[model samples]
Target: MVRKLLPPLASGFLFGMGLTISGMTDPGRVRGFLDIFGDWDPTLAFVMGGAVVVMAIAWRVQARMVKPVFGERFSLPDRTDLDPRLLAGAAVFGVGWGVAGLCPGPAVASLALSPVYAAPFVAAMLVGMLLQKLTMERKVSNP
Candidate 1:
């Protein structure tokens, strides 16, 4: 169990450290990124670019591996095509991100440092997730 959890835990710790170092833990920095008409900050774009590069490399590495260090195999989402639900979700996510300036991962990480911002962010995120789940459940049941 320890072996199974260690890699994911280490990855999460590194991710949190990156968020902390890049000022992603700061809600004001994120809010500045969202602000286009006001004093805008483009630093978050650089951080996102860096993350994209890292994710591309990680994807390549994972593709080459037959099995993950901890798991039998990586279970990735099978969906390859976009649909209305996907598009709508993306739009909603983008709007929420633009307004709040904090994505879920960084928001959760920021909780350890700043509850004043993180608490509301997390609460909203939970509500959004719950709503999505309920909607999906209703659709599934009705259909």
Candidate 2:
């Protein structure tokens, strides 16, 4: 069990650290990034660009590997459809990000820095996740 969990736990810790180090956990910085008409900050773009480059390399490596180091097989998303549900969800996500200036990742990471401020965002995120799961499950069962 420890072996199975270690990789994910380590990865999450590292990701949180990166978010903190890059100042992504700061709502002000994130809001600044979104304020294109005003004092827009470009740090998030650089961070995202670096992440994209790293992930591109990782994907190339994954293409060469038959299986992950700790898993029997890779569990990658195969969805490519542009359905109404996807569009609605994306619009909702964008609105939430703009309003709160924090997505799920940065919100969760911000818990370590300011639990009081992060609590509401995390709670709302969990509620949204649960609602999505219940909706999907009901659809699958009824269909």
Candidate 3:
């Protein structure tokens, strides 16, 4: 149980700490990054680039490994094709991120740092997720 939980817990903790330290928890900072036509902040680019680099290395390591360092099997996304649902979801996510300046990761981390402000965002996010699930279920059932 501890083994199963510890890796995820530690990873999340480290990710949250990184977000907080990188000023990603600050909506103003994120908004500034989104403001490419105006006072654009490039810091988030560096953060994202660093993440990409890290993930690239991780992917390379995974390619050589038979199984994950902490799991029964490496659960991976099987889909390689794009659909309307995927495109729409990505669009909605981008719009929401631009408007709110807080993606799920920073919003979740902000729960511990600034719950007063984070609560509504988190609640709405959960509601949105539930709605999406139900919509998808209905579509599948009807089709």
Candidate 4:
């Protein structure tokens, strides 16, 4: 159990810490990044770039490995086709991120600092996720 859970826990802890340290937990900072037309912040770009570089290396490592060290198999997305659903979801996510300045990672981390603000965002996110799951399940069953 510990072997299965520890890597994910560690990764999530590191992710949360990175988000907090990068000022992503601050709505003002995130909003500033989104405000490219106005007083835009460039720090998030650097943060994003760093993440991309790290993930690129991780991907390369994964390609070399037969399976994850902790898992029997690596569960990864297999879909390569771009569809309307993907575009629509991206647009919705972008709008939500811009308006709220709170994506899931930062919002969850903010629960430690400001439950009053994070609680509603987290609740809404959960509801949205549940709705998506139901929609997907219905489509799969009907198809």
Error of 4 at 57 (Å): 1.6
TM-score of each: 0.83, 0.92, 0.91, 0.90
- lDDT for every model? 0.88, 0.94, 0.93, 0.92
Q: Which scores better on lDDT, 3 or 4?
A: 3
lDDT of 2 at 79: 58
Q: Show the colliding residue pairs in model 1.
A: none
Off by over 4 Å in 4: 78-81
- Best to worst by TM-score, what's the order? 2, 3, 4, 1
Which candidate, 2 or 3, would have the higher lDDT against the true structure? 2
Q: On residues 48-81, what C-alpha lDDT tens digit does candidate 2 reach at each position?
A: 9999999999999999998989889998866576
Best by lDDT: 2
- Check candidate 2 and list the clashing pairs: none
> Least accurate stretch of 10 residues (summed lDDT) in model 1?
73-82
Best by TM-score: 2
Q: Is candidate 3 or candidate 4 better by TM-score?
A: 3
Q: Per-candidate RMSD vs. true structure?
A: 2.2, 1.5, 1.6, 1.7
**On a 0 to 1 TM-score scale, where does candidate 2 land against the true structure?**
0.92
Model 3: CA > 4 A from native: 78-81
- Taking the candidates one at a time, how many backbone clashes does each contain? 0, 0, 0, 0
Per-residue error for 2 in candidate 4, Å, reads: 3.4
